[model samples]
Each structure stands twice: as structure tokens, then as C-alpha cells.
Target: MADVIKSLNLLETLKESIENNKLSDVKDAVEDLLISRINLAVVGDRGDEKATFINCLLGLGPGDDGSAPSPSPAAPEEVACYLNPKHPDFRLWDLPPVPSTSPFQPEGYMEKVKFPRYNAVFVTFTQTPHPHSVEVFLEARSLQQQTVYFILFTSAKDTEKNLEEKRKASLVALTSHGVSLPKVYLVRPSTLEKLDFPGLLEEMARDLPEIRAHALLLALPTLTPTLITQKKESFKALVWAAASLSGGVSAIPVPFVASMVDSSVGVRILTKAQSSLCLDNESVERLARQRGADPARLKELRTCVLSVEVTKGEVKKRLAAAEKEIATVSSKLVEMAMPRHARSVSRSFAAMLQALNGAIDEMAADAEKIMAAALGKGK
Candidate 1:
């Protein structure tokens, strides 16, 4: 209910801007929407484990260009920043191992890593939760870093009882340190769908700032159907803003020329959607490689035309076609939200909304198929 109202308020704000011909403001809003930044810090001792966890988070295979390096025992002593290939604004910073001192001190380590800057923190360990790891979480809590995770990376071959025991031990250790309520996530980075990985992601989505959470959802690889659905729904507000921006830009008075602004907007929207949904060539190939599946075979699973390519010419044609196909139904709803003074852009807005919505649905469906095929499920 509150979320729905908030969404409606945003839509109304955009509509008001379009009605008043505030195209520049609308453009800024859309730019901010598409480029929000999320800084995630993965704090753990094991270089190999950190690399694997970071790779899985960023949808990269071990050998991919932007994947974290599983450095030898002599890992780099400084913080290493791993850029998300799909979204430059999003970053994963792998901090050096917390010093294994008898009396763990987190202040110097936190300052060195600029801990306050990260939107969220993940403290990971292979077995027992390190004393340093718990101290780090406690320090982060004191510093108002509310979004933190204590993760135990367990072997897939480990029995359920063994996993439960490890979690209990970790919780006990955390509680002993005055943590009122302690929660630990047991995961296998190789298979994020197993154990507590999905729940951890859900908590991240709920706990982080709204825009950063949205960025995380869209930037992550389409691993689970639940995530796929969340990613698809996250685009709703973006689609509305994009279409409104298109309408607003076109509404601006230009001497003796018809504005074809929606084409460019549509192209940008779908291109971002393509990458966010993991329909782009690079993302598909990386996921395929990570799952030991042939990239070409996975690519064949993407049946949507826009999922394959989003171009200006293609966008223009689709916009016109979608407008014609859904105008009767969409126009009524769009018209209700648009003011009388902004009627000129109503058709354009409706067309862009229709085209982008259809493309997003098609791309999301294609991503599901690709993921299924990559996971050895028949397409």
C-alpha cells in the first residue's frame, strides 16, 4: 500500500513535469534513475573464497575480465575494487583480511577500507566465524552501517547437520560478543540458489537504500526466477519515468519540426533493460561459461528480437507498431494520468510505454529460458 502510493506519487511528479514542459528536469531524473551507485564491500580472509563470492555476485566467471583474482596466499594487502562490467556505477570492493590479533581491533581496518562509504557489508568465512569478522560487524553497527551480513561459506558436500552446527556455533560466538540478535547465512557461492543465498539477497534488497537496492537487483545476474521477477517489477518505475521523459522532451516546442524524441529514449531504455536482464551478449556468455554450458547454445534460448538487438531503427518501428496495437487500451490509462495541456505527448507516451513494457516482458521471459537452459533444465 505505501509502496504503491509512493510509486503513484512518482508517476504524478513525472506527469506534472511533462505537462509543464520541464524536459530538462525529467531528463535529470531519468539519468539519475539509470545511474545510481551501489558500493558493496566483501570482507573475508580467503582470497579464493572472496574471488568466488565476488564473481558470483557480479555474474562473472572466474576468468572473466572484471572478475576478482584468486590471488596466491600473498594476496594484495590493499583494498581491491572490482567494477561491475554491466553497470559501471556499481562496485564490489574486496577488503584485505582483518588482522588476526588476539584482541581484534576494527577501527584502523575500517578506516583503511573506508568502511563508512559502502552501502552494505558482507563478512564471509569458510568455517567458524572469525573473531575478527564478528568484531568488524559490531564496529560497523556502532558506525550506523545497519546493512551487514555474516556469511558462512560451506562445502556443498557438508551434511545439513554439519551446516546447522556451524551456524549455531557462529551465532553463539556473535551473541557472546553482545550482539542482541545474531543471524548467519550459510551459502555455497558456486550455487547461489542453495541454502541461505537467496534469503541474503532478499534481505539486502529490503535493507539497503531504495535506489541502491534497485540498482543491486538490476545489476545482478538473473539467477533465480524470484530474482528475475523482482528485476522485472523493479523496471516499472523506470519505464514510467522513461516514457514520461520521452513525452516531456517531445512536448518542447521546436520551430516547424515534428519531434521524434521517443525513438532515442526507447532505444536507451531497452538497451539498459537488455543489459540489466542479462540478455546482452557478454552477460549471456559469462553465465554460460560459469555454468559450463556453451554460450552459443544459451544464446539460442533468447527468442526475443529486442533481447538480441536494440537499435534506433528497431525502436522506432516497434514504438509505432506498439502504439497501434495497444493504443486503445493504453491511451485511456495514460490519458487519465496526463493533463489536458499535455495531450500532445499522450500518444507518444503511450506508445513508448507499450513498446518498452512489451520488450521488457519479452527480455525477462528470454532470460528465464536462458537461465533454465544454462542450469541443465530443458528450454
Candidate 2:
């Protein structure tokens, strides 16, 4: 059931590539041939370019003074989100990832480049959703959906009256497609800040469901199985992602048990002074639970063994070393757990990395099956 659903996602990716002329459906029929397995291989054009294309699409293209070859553009021609671990463009990078190379490279890039299977991708800007912008968004939504559905993200950029005027224009353009009703959100960043600034930042945050979607994704395991089952393998709409965030640790009593992970957080100072990995099973279990890992599912996964080719000897070695490494990482986590500004953010960020590691292990096993099949090799 999982493989079939995953393959359907591949079909969606293939369809977009075909329409864009990156691949010939008839020529690359292997992608479509499988009925029981998901195509883990990321087969698509350059998403970084697509990211840049998106930038250009949104009229934020390099802000080129035509200077310095326009900073070499982030990427070229596909559905780029963010594939690089080294990417430093934004202040906070909350997007998730898988192991990838040539993050700038097209080969095996699609699967590696994580994206929100957001049914409605609301792109909020200080500007109104113009007609051409609406058309671009419509096509973006159409390329992936069976019958075109999506969202419009905006900020109450002007005064209340002007905001209403822009909202009406955007809403009208968005719903203009009689076939769909777009999801919309107004950003308000001030929700995180108690201080006063020009209201622009608050206005932006008010409608920033897109940004929130990234944070929400980190906490996605909390989304009930029913919502997940309905969407199958796709990302929940930003609205749904937003809805699920209410289940995060922040939503819990005393916010993260208040002292459970923190009591040992100070060990980081000692560990950093000497370099160490001090977290233990209790800590990991607390964290794993905090990360929302299902003990039952992990047990089930042990039996499934989707992919693990290393010898028992190697597995033991990695397990031993990783055990040791966890102690060092744990101590460091404690250190950062205290920094005023980066405290929760860093902790959540670290927790996110841990979650990604688990997801990668699952995906790796799935990927190696196809990888071995393609390479004509076997364990």
C-alpha cells in the first residue's frame, strides 16, 4: 500500500516533467512501469533552477543591478525548494532535507529535494496578487493536482481599507477558477515578538503560513494517521500543517516538560570544553518520544528491514560509534539549549535533524532496493 501510494507521487513528478519537456513519457516509461514499488530515484530537471525560476516568477530575481552575473542564480529549471545543506541565503532555514549531492545537480535531485506536497502553495508578498501572478500560481497548482487546487498567501500590506481592497482583488482572482477555492492566510510575525516595530513585519508574519508550514513540517509526525492516510504520501496543505502544529512540544504542558531535557543541558559546557557525546538511552528515548517516534512502528520497521547492506560487523561498528557520537551531540545540544535567542529554536532545529536522520534511514532502505535493482547487484 505504501509503495503504490509513493509511486503515484512519482507519476505526479513524471507528469510535470513530461509537460515541461524535461522527459519524454514514452522514452522514460520505466518510471511508470512499476506498479508495486515507489520510484525513490529523484528523476527531474534542476529544481535549484526552478527555485531561481520561482524567484524570477515572483519578480525577485536576483534583484539584479545586472551586477556580478546576478550572483550566479540559485538554480535553473525545475521545482526547486532547497536541496543544499550549505545553503545560507535566509536567516532561518526550516525546510527539511534528505542526503543529496550537486544540490545544484539534476541527477537524483528530485527525490533528494524535499517539498511540501502542499495542495495550495500560498506565496505571500507585500504586493497584491496580480493577474499574471495568479495565472502563474494557477499553472503551478495545475501541474501537480488532478484538477488544479491551491492557495493565495498575502499580507495586509496597506491600511485596513487598502488591505481589504487588495484582499478582494486576490480573493476574486484566486476563486475566479470556478473549479477551485484557494486556501489563504495573512502573515503576522509579531506573534513571535512582544516589541513594537513597523507593522510590516507583523503583517508579513500574519500571512506567513508558508514559513509556518516549514516549522509545522518539523512537527508533522504529530499529525494523526487519518490526515496522513488521506493525503497518503503528499504534504498536507499549509492549512492542515498549521492545524497540526498545535500538537507540538510547544503545545504541551509547561512547554517541553520544562525541565526534562534541560536538567542535563548544562553538560554541554563541560563537553564543549573537552569534546564529548554524553546523552544516554533515557535521554534518547525522551528525545525519540519528543521527536514523536512510534516505538511500535520502529519495531515493525526492524522486521521490514527495507535496506541495510552493511555487514553485521559494519553495522555493529556504526552502531557503537553512533552511540558514542550521540553522547557528544547530546552535550552540545545542552550547551545550545541555554542560549537565550537560539534556545528553543536551536533545540527544535536539532530535533528536526534527528527526525530527518530517521526518515533518511527509511528512505535509504527503500532507495537501495531500486538502486540495487538498477545496478544489477544484490546483497
Model 2 agreement with the true structure over 147-262: per-residue lDDT tens digits: 21122222324456764665566567667743266544433321111112112222322333322322222212211222223222322211111111211223324332232232
Q: lDDT, candidate 1, residue 363?
A: 89
Error of 2 at 111 (Å): 16
Can you write out model 1's per-residue Cα lDDT over 282-351, one digit (the tens) per residue?
8888787777888999899888888998888888788889777764665568768566776677776677
Misplaced by over 4 Å in model 1 are 1-29, 72-76, 102-104, 249-260, 335-344, 377-379
- Reference-based TM-score, model 1: 0.87
Per-model TM values vs. the true structure: 0.87, 0.25
Worst 10 residues of 1 by lDDT: 251-260
The Cα error of candidate 2 at residue 29, in Å, is 28
Error of 2 at 231 (Å): 19
Q: Indicate the worst ten consecutive residues by lDDT in candidate 2.
A: 269-278
Q: Report each candidate's C-alpha RMSD, comma-separated, in the order given.
A: 3.8, 22.4
Q: Work out candidate 2's RMSD over C-alphas.
A: 22.4
| lDDT for residue 291 in candidate 1, whole number 0-100 | 78
